[model samples]
Target: MFDLDRWIEIFQTLSKNKLRTVLSGFTIAFAILLFTLLFGIGNGLKHTFEEQFKGDAQNSIYIRSGRTTKPYKGLQSGRRIQFRNEDSKFMNDKFSEKIQFFSPNIERFNVQAIYKGEQNSYTVRGVYPDYQALEEAVMEQGRFLSVLDIKNKAKVVAIGRLVEKDLYGQLSALGKNITLGGISYKVIGVFSDPGGDNDERFIYTPFTTAQGIYKPNDEVDRYGLTFNPSLSVDQALSFSNLLTKLLKEKHNVDPRDQRAIRVQNYAEGTKNVEQFMGVLNIIILFIGIGTLVAGIIGISNIMVYIVKERTKELGIRKALGATPKSIIGMIMMESIFVTALAGYAGLLLGVFTLNALGDSLEKYFILNPSVETYVVVGATIILIIAGTVAGYIPAKRAARIKPIVALNDE
Candidate 1:
């Protein structure tokens, strides 16, 4: 079955048409290359989003206030609304069983912090002890706010990793004084965040202390609540609905007003991420298939042309007692050889490009590049099928041509 003469003859014919063969092969290679890169970037986007989600409990819910949308029980629209600390207290008292962590957050505007002469402008957050758990903060040095610190309205502060790096220089931050809004506060802890782009350029202090010192207006921006992780997604949903209703009544807004207050549901957010990822993958798959189909069509057209050019040679072989099966075998072998070489070459090129860019991608890109074993296997099978189908029709046409007609034309 492995005829050296037959192989030599096929190679010789292809070599004679070098430019045409290269063009055909290039089509398949580009198809695979584009497919690989698109899918890699899509996966990278999904990975970035998933990393953002990992910064907090997936079952958590966020409640923030915005201006009222509709006239609420005769109150005019365009009124600025505020969520108070008492609202957070009310939730803890009412939903003690459902809620895991409750933190009322208040923001200080454009606070200037100074450490030894280095100055930085950062937002100051007033939070309870549980805020650390909600933010997924890892303490780098010293400790986070203890219960006593929040209870007694101590002036203890926690600095983010970036903040520490900018201010502390070579010295440790613990037990040092950092001035916020011209008031000196002792640094109690230094912290780091897993997600690099997020707002870790701040200082956190006790909510009560912040209310008394900076924001005496007592109007807080938002309240954050995380449910017990052991709770089901449905259970989280139920809690969110209940909290939304309770907050609406407390804020004196119409319960039906969709924009009166915003409650960001983690379950819905997770679902949206999955749906987006699915759409991206479907798009990638279709583009890849389309490219490959074009290449296959090109292969089919070239094979037909090759058959036309070799008519006289096929006729001579047929007259000399070569079977139709042998003729088909010769065509199929050439098709397979071209398909495998081009496809494998394209695959290697894609992998090499990805490897070269992987580190730079990880630093500046939000997406992950992935190539599974099954994907490779699937591509290989698709290439084989494409080659076989392209060869089949032309070989059949050659077998049908009578030896007398083919020889007379030559």
Candidate 2:
């Protein structure tokens, strides 16, 4: 299979027609390059979407009440809807099987926190022990809030990773005393959240303690819960819809009102994201196929032109005892070699460019774009095969041309 003489002939022919060789190579190379870049960028866009949703539990749902914009059933417009402890009991009783984890959230912003000489303003939330799971927080030190802490109305707080960093510095915040709003509390845990810096700056306390201290009348700011993980996205969405409708009815709010009782379901967002990602995958596949098709056409045209230009040379060889098979084989070998080499060069360049453009395209919502080696290599192999097939058509016709006719015509 390793024909040194045949390869030498190919090399001589290629060197003699440098322009033809470069033209053929560039066609395939540019196609592969464009294909690689497009595929990499598509993957990067997917990564961005995944990153955005990674901040929260995929199955979590949040409920927040706001001022109603429309009047309903004798109630005036602009009525402020309030969530309460009774609402928590209502959800647990109504959807016991569908709810996995639930927490009534009462948040305080700009809360002044002091740990010895360190002082900062951080967000403070009052939530049940299940709030940890709802927020998808991981305990970095000590432990998260416990049922016993809530039951005892313990003056214990679980601070965020950044909260500890800002106040306690390198020293551990666990089991230390931290003062918040002129009230002293023992630090029981330090947790980190995937939601990034904003989430990691929060301090959490027992719902009972905060409700008693801040709102003794039993008012809740919002509700956070995760649906049962076994539920499908559609089922989760239905559950949230029913929950929102029921909450609105319980509060005597307008059913058509958008702002009265808002249910923010991650499932709905996930369904939309899945649909988008599906479309994105289809688009990427289309672009890749289109790029490959264009490359094939370009290389095919160039191969035909190369054969046409070498018509006289092929005829002279045939007259000099060159077999038709040898003539076709030489042309095919030359075309395939150039195609494979150029395609690989283009692939490497595209990959290197993606690596160099890493993170720089994040502002464009493209994260660490890259292409798999097998994908690009497969494309290159396909181009080489196309070149060989394309070259064979013209080579076969040239092989049939009579030497006398070819020589007289030229």
Candidate 3:
């Protein structure tokens, strides 16, 4: 099967038509290059979308109160809806199995934080221990708020990395006091957020402490919940809808009023994004395969031309006792070699391009864009099959050449 002499003959034939061979090879190479680049870019887009979901739990849902848009149950429209600690407790008690984590968020705007005579204005929030996981906060030092802190209304603060740096400036803030709204609270922890520096400008305290200090009564700004991982997106959405309905009923808001109880289903958002990416991948594949089909057609046409030009030589070989199978094998081998070599060049170029831009692209949320090894192997197989098929009809024509007829052709 390994015929060195036959390979040498095939190379000689290809070398004789240098321009034609180069053009044919270029077509195949360009097609593969386009396919690789499009696929890599599609993957990059997917990575960018995924990075946006990193700041929160994938299945998390947020519930916030808004002004009523329609009157219901004798209540007038335009009534501002508000949530309290009782509502959070009721939801936690009622949906214990369905919920993974729940936190009632209480926000105070433009709060002054003073530490060692250095003061800066930042938004302050009161949250529970579960808010740590819900917000995907990474503790850089000390510990986050605990259940005991909330129960006892402890005057302890967990500051963000930005807040710590602004107020303390490289010095350890733990066990140190910070005056928030004129109330002295000991620093307990410092945290970093996936959402970058903007998210690190807020400080967190125990919900009870915030309620006591801010005197917003029992009112909370919003509620955050993450569903159990075992639930599907549809299932989680159904649960969110049920919760919304229950809240509307409990708060005496209109059942059909959408604005009274606003719920953000992160699971649904993520699912929609994934569906969009699926469509994007399909579009990329369609265009890539279309380019490859054109290249294959070009290879087929060139092989036919090669056969036509070498009809007399093929006939001479037949007359000299060469078998039809050997002639077909020679033609097919040439087609395969040209395609494989060009494909390798395209693959190498695509990989090198991705590697060169990987670092720069990461700043835009695109991680390493690469084709898997198995996909590359599969593409190589496809190239070989395509090369053989492209040459098949031409090789058969060469095999059927009659020595007498071919010798007479000018």
Best model per TM-score? 2
User: Residue pairs in steric clash, candidate 1?
Assistant: 44-367, 44-368, 45-367
Candidate with the larger TM-score of 1 and 2: 2
- Candidates sorted on lDDT, descending: 2, 3, 1
> Residue 15 error for model 2, in Å?
2.6
lDDT of 3 by residue, 150-205 (tens): 99999999999999899899898888999988889999999999978888988999
Best prediction by lDDT: 2
RMSD of 2: 2.7
Q: Candidate 3 — which pairs collide?
A: none
Global Cα lDDT for candidate 2: 0.92
Lowest-scoring 10 consecutive residues by lDDT in candidate 1? 365-374
Which of the predicted structures, 1 or 2, would earn the higher lDDT when compared with the native?
A: 2
**What is candidate 2's CA lDDT for residue 177?**
99
Q: Which ten residues in a row have the lowest lDDT in candidate 2?
A: 401-410
Model 2 residue 292 CA deviation in Å = 1.9
| Candidate 3 weakest lDDT stretch, 10 residues | 372-381
Per-residue CA lDDT of candidate 1, range 110-192, in tens?
A: 79999878998898999988888878888999998878988899998999988887888878899999999889999999988
Ranking by TM-score: 2, 3, 1
